[model samples]
Target: MKRKWDSSDERYFGIGIYRPKTVENVGSLWRTAYVLGASFVFLIDAKYKKKSSDVLKVWARIPLFQFETIEAFIQTVPYSCQLIGVEMDDSATPIQDFFHPDRAIYLLGSENNGLPKSLKSKCQELVILPGEPSLNVAAAGSIVVYDRILKKVNRSLLIQ
Candidate 1:
């Protein structure tokens, strides 16, 4: 049977994984981002093409950027794209009420520590998972990517 994922987006956003400890997780995140129409996937403070995960294969198609630091990566984001942090913080807006930007870079922090305080301070917006304690890095990033695609698709339908 044909799948809905065959669809495309005119303006695709990006997703990122920050210092992920496992190769498998990053590989999974990259695959999800690719399947969901993300324009790119990025790595922060992590070695590029050093792991034997399936990520290298996916990287062949989707552009992946390696940043020396989160600050450096944040600086590279286009002004038109909002840097949204996926973290559970007291000040974070619940994902349900938050407005997914038309162009966004959804950043997921390390799986063990969540987002760093310095990175949190820099994000334009922080979105909380709510109810769940937290999710594994890849799982959380996939949810955010899926949410963006769903909202974008629905918005386009309304305009038509």
Candidate 2:
């Protein structure tokens, strides 16, 4: 589906989780993604269930793509759009230092286990949030989206 933003504003992004184990997390993440202007949300090897946490009924406002496998998801990534992985890994750049791509899709791992190595290797860029012992999947995804929005706003202010 076409995005709400105009063509001149090339920046657009989607957020999704891989093998998410909790419905609440998916609902909360979906709401956050919609509120933060994410172009879309997705699930990899998982299914979403209705939950009360999504007060905005984000399903109606945003698109959610489900892929049976990682390869299937990779096939749908838009041309020229980068796939970014959000995980706590030694090779990942810290969130504060990472630059938000003009067109990107941010993928987060499940609540129990972080991103698998195969998927992590495919990401053009991987960003790690602050703190140890990891964080809730929904919280981490929200932070990534928020950071992207914050940086974009700061960049526009500078250009003006």
TM-score of each candidate structure, all chains considered together: 0.87, 0.92
Deviation from native of the Cα of residue 116 in model 1, angstroms: 1.0
52-113: candidate 2 lDDT, tens digit per residue: 55667788999988999999999999999999999999999999899999899999998888
RMSD (Å) of each candidate, 1 decimal: 5.9, 3.7
Candidate lDDT (C-alpha), each: 0.82, 0.91
Model 2 C-alpha lDDT versus the unseen true structure: 0.91
Candidate 1 segments whose C-alpha is farther than 4 A from its true place: 1-10, 48-56
lDDT, model 2, position 22 = 88
How many clashes does each candidate structure show, in the order listed?
0, 0
